[model samples]
Target: MSSPGPRSSVSPSGRSWRDRRLDRDGSLGLRLTLAAVAAFLVLVPFALLAVLVVGSWTPLHELDAAVTAALHRFAADHPGWVRVMKAWTHVFSPGPLRVAALAVVVWVWRRGSRRLALWVVTTMAVGGALGALLKLLVGRDRPELLDPVARAAGFSFPSGHALNATLAAGVLLLVFLPFARGRPGGRLLLWTVAVLLVGVTGLSRVALGVHWASDVLGGWLLGGAVVAATAAAFRTWREQAGLPAGRTTVDGVAPELVDPHA
Candidate 1:
């Protein structure tokens, strides 16, 4: 049998191909929420850095000496554990894993959910770049502790690994939160994983002696701020685009589909 004629598939209003896929709703509350989050995200990192500079400046010089002494003590007692911790921390190095994250984000955005994909990509890109820029501006030094397993040659005020993981995980939480909002079990699982990833990544930097406690804290704050900002921008764009409000399913059967990509 022949396929249905073009008329059968065309929208009766003859809306343009692109127009049919757009949504058209804008909640005042959502716009406000997005704006607040974005503003917070943009400012928090700088504040975090300032705090770190003030609080950790002196302690940083002493940190390496402390770490060296601790390492010597640990080596005499538990050398195997030290090696294991180094390997675990090295696994989180941003070089190769970041490339993988990029690929995953692109693939998910193109094939599955643009909103989720954008969440991942935006958080990582913005947060990682910001962290690097902050490090450059500060131009601090890494601890001269036991030789680093992963060679990150740059100023070490805000830990990049900590920031990257924190942003990525935080955005994932936000994206999933809407759907799981009322479902306590699902929400708990989602948030728990997100927290673990963010927290563990931060701790790993400290465990490896690449960052001071303050740097990790700064990175977390910096990353969270970016996620909030990106989420706000996304919500604003969604509102302005006026796509169908609320969640959309995987299939294109809703009243209208919002192109988050737009």
Candidate 2:
């Protein structure tokens, strides 16, 4: 009798590892849900592109109307708002923003998966290149603005800096989600900081006269699509490779060593 000796009291060394595949009953539903969302994100961009293509015939005339309205309003009142808008240009300044982003990534690298770091670099680099190619094809001219703060050399239909910012922010989020395991509060804080930095960079481009509002918007759409596609690819790769999805790393130290999500 002896109270059955606390059946299987010891947990297995790899007990934290969980299977990522859906169970039989849930598989169909999960697959369908993912497919629907994937199709939506993919198709939305093409629809937006269609609008831009049709609008190109009168882009300059449209731009003139918009800029004139804005200037007339600014001339009447709210000079401070104009200055504030101009100040936003600082966000797109290449040097300081780049350093700040890199600092966040380095700070997050406690147990540091080199693969994750590589993915971040690849996402940004490929997104930037593709954006540049598209800009060349569109060959859109920059907006005409008086006393612009900085000069941008690239064709201006879609801002490359804005595109890169969105991709870098989004890919980092996906790469970090699987690794996050500590108090929910800390995870939320980190994500908020990352998002704000990306948003500010994109906004800065418009304020500085380096890109139009539409250019920044297009960059966000294109960059976000690339990021989502990359994340989906990574999910498939991890599944095929049979790596642990949400488990703390066991190859080096015990789960308790690095505070789970740090």
Candidate 3:
């Protein structure tokens, strides 16, 4: 019998080169599909809102005006509610949220999760910068109320308070979720808190008469998009490093964080 030609290279796991290539291509395709889906879910809404805001769509403008007027009227009648919203907005403002994120970055870095720390910083910075840039580009005015419950300066197409709150909630949730992995109740609580924070922050902006309904909605969409995009990028990095794909929804951005020695 003729001697066999050079044999195909096989990994220790017994996967041939062609099998490995196919696996890699499939993984990459999955990642791309995920990214596309995320973009569609978040960016599409944000872009549509931006277009409507820019074009001064009559129905949207009418809806914003009606919502603002109704909220302002309610604030006028309920001093206690106004005070509570003011307190909530102040506590969750961008400044305090950024400070909290910085503290987490320090904690994670000290724990030897240097990359995770970097991700926290990058996500916050990018979100903040994008918010500011969009504010300038859109140059939309804040809702003007005869008796404003709260006041904010600068352009207001997207509510900064809502954007920052969403970012902070998402970052904190992902960073701490590894610790809650095995506890269903803990996971449920975390999700509830995150949703509550994002929802109330946006509502406070509209109720306080500093932002239109659309503005707050825009902030939420943009903020969520930022978080999803950065998290996806991080996931891609983990895969390229030969790590198992993380169930980000359940385990957070880096389940490796649960390892005391990781």
Candidate 4:
């Protein structure tokens, strides 16, 4: 019998095209990619609002007014839910966030990743400052068609709670994702919680009748910008310090499993 034909080599770890691309590029590349997307989200939405939506846009303004008024009235009509929402909303406010920030910083430091801890703190600080500055520039009035159910003082173009919550949650998740590398469904769960936190916090402002819907949307976009920039910076700094760039492998997948070439 003729000898068996040569058998093709199998990777032993069934990798895919995406895996190979990620492995070749690694962590810094991934961060930079995300940063590009985030920058687009940040600039585009804000510019659209500043140039088109804020003025010379009667229909959009009407929509914002309708939604804001509806939510405010709905919450007021439901006394029980209003109370719960108010309490839940505070968790994202400055008072509660101060404690949460302290806890996260301490935990990261104790875990021996001072760079990550510092990244969290600084990202939040800078994002908050930017939010404040943007609010000043927009100088949009709060929705006063309904009585405000919560105390607030500021120009309302962008909701500070929404912006701050997005930044804080995004930074925390990105920084700690490496730890979830091997845990099943860990990244999904983290993302779910983060998105929920951001969504609810933004809605809470509308629920209280203190912010228009557009304000929350702007905050969300702005927060995305901050998260992307800080994440990119964090990884970049590691490379500068001579630390090996983290592999692009996520959720503990071995490079070979995802990289077809491997």
Candidate 5:
């Protein structure tokens, strides 16, 4: 008797994710459980990254050394280029992030998406606290380059600039994805831009000779974890508000629990 190779896969139970969603019912308990699992899955890589980079890992150390050396070499001939990277680096600096977040908060609040505005601020606040905790735990030092083009203070296990940039980019993506519904091209373009921004921001640290390659990697991973958690939280809020699962536009946002504008 011939057996069926496999049953046809069901459409993602809900929407989004690997283009296929898991079969999760609409229940607060289920959402919380799912959120926790998703957060843990995202955070595991960050934890592993910290362990690998903080320890005496030869391969990571070698790669870090090679990248730092190459960037240092490039800086020697292209001083102007290094200066550009240094300037670009400020886009993700603490001051810019704070300013951007404030603007976003105000914009979203005016648009009647107070929940989203709150999430935006919370993500940054949580990132700063988590970053400090990770740095204290890892206790790693900044890169000692032959010729550093920039100076930094504090432990350098994870690049704060990279982390904050990633969070900000992720927030923008999440906020705008609803606008991109039914337009795969726009979604793809946004994803590409987000990736490039995150990559360049992380690389800026190494290029300017302030952070090791491994530190940037750790920041990316950690930032990814935080983004995942925040996205899940926002999704839950949307679902509870009776918004559409797959497509939700700014015009569709329900009044938040605490409406400052009201």
Candidate 6:
């Protein structure tokens, strides 16, 4: 009789050897678990904040009032500071962030990573749209400060500036982090800049007396949830395509971008 055929290497589930290795390593499971946990943590607070804002919770309202009043007073006294914040907010506003993301999308698309480019566009578009819808649904008003140093129009539970800043920061960090792979300092600097941009942009919205602290906080939480959710989805797609499950915190969302021939 003919020799038995070589033993099949494929798993019972039809996964290849590489996929079986990935399953044994548990990297994909860990990544998805972390992303789910992150999303849950952020969304819970955001939901609480929304509920409180809608219910007009006394303590939260009082805190918002106090913070807004304090910031307004400071803005009223410091003309230079107000001017700087205005410039900073404008530079990081939704319009500019969209333009920057568009540039990145174009670059990546040209580089043949159409899916990565599409991911960027979808994340930004969905985040912005959802934020706008939440504002309308919440029907929360912007902080009405006496002698306001800056003005913003529309419902303001989530500060548009803060949300857009956060979306932009996450998008840019994930897109560019691949280039900083081997350089620890470069990675640190990238993370530092992203954090500062998100933090200060939110703070500026409050300091300008256009958004309450809670509004900025809500923006941040929602924006973070969107990024985490999208990153998790992208990682799953990569795994299905037989690509490495690169960690977003280290290897970024698209490690293949670092390959010149890719």
Q: Which structure among the candidates has the greatest TM-score?
A: 3
* Best of the two (2, 3) by lDDT: 3
Q: lDDT-based ranking, best first?
A: 3, 6, 5, 4, 1, 2
Candidates sorted by TM-score, descending order?
Answer: 3, 6, 5, 4, 1, 2
TM-score of each: 0.66, 0.63, 0.88, 0.75, 0.81, 0.86
- Looking at model 1, report the run of 10 residues with the lowest lDDT sum: 248-257
The TM-score that candidate 5 achieves is 0.81
Clashing pairs in 5: 12-21
Which lDDT tens digits does candidate 3 get at residues 27-114?
5555655675776787888999999999999999999999999999999999999999999999999999999999999999988889
Better of 3 and 6 by TM-score: 3
lDDT of 2 by residue, 110-174 (tens): 55554555556666667777787888877888766565445667688677777776766675555
Candidate that would win on lDDT: 3
What local lDDT score does residue 81 receive in model 5, on the 0 to 100 scale? 84
Q: Write the per-residue lDDT of candidate 6 for residues 1-262, one digit (tens) a residue.
A: 8989987675547765455444634555554555667678768888989999999999999999999998889889999999999999998899999999999999999998998998999889989998999999999988886588988899988888888888999999999999999999999999999999999999999999989899999999889888888887788778767787677889889998988485
Write down the RMSD of candidate 1 (Cα, Å): 12.1
lDDT (C-alpha) at residue 59 in model 3:
100
| Candidate 5 residue runs with Cα over 4 Å from true position | 1-26, 247-262
Higher-ranked by TM-score: 1 or 5 = 5
lDDT winner, 1 or 2? 1
User: Which digits, one per residue and each the tens of the lDDT, describe model 4 over residues 150-175?
Assistant: 76777987788888888877766665
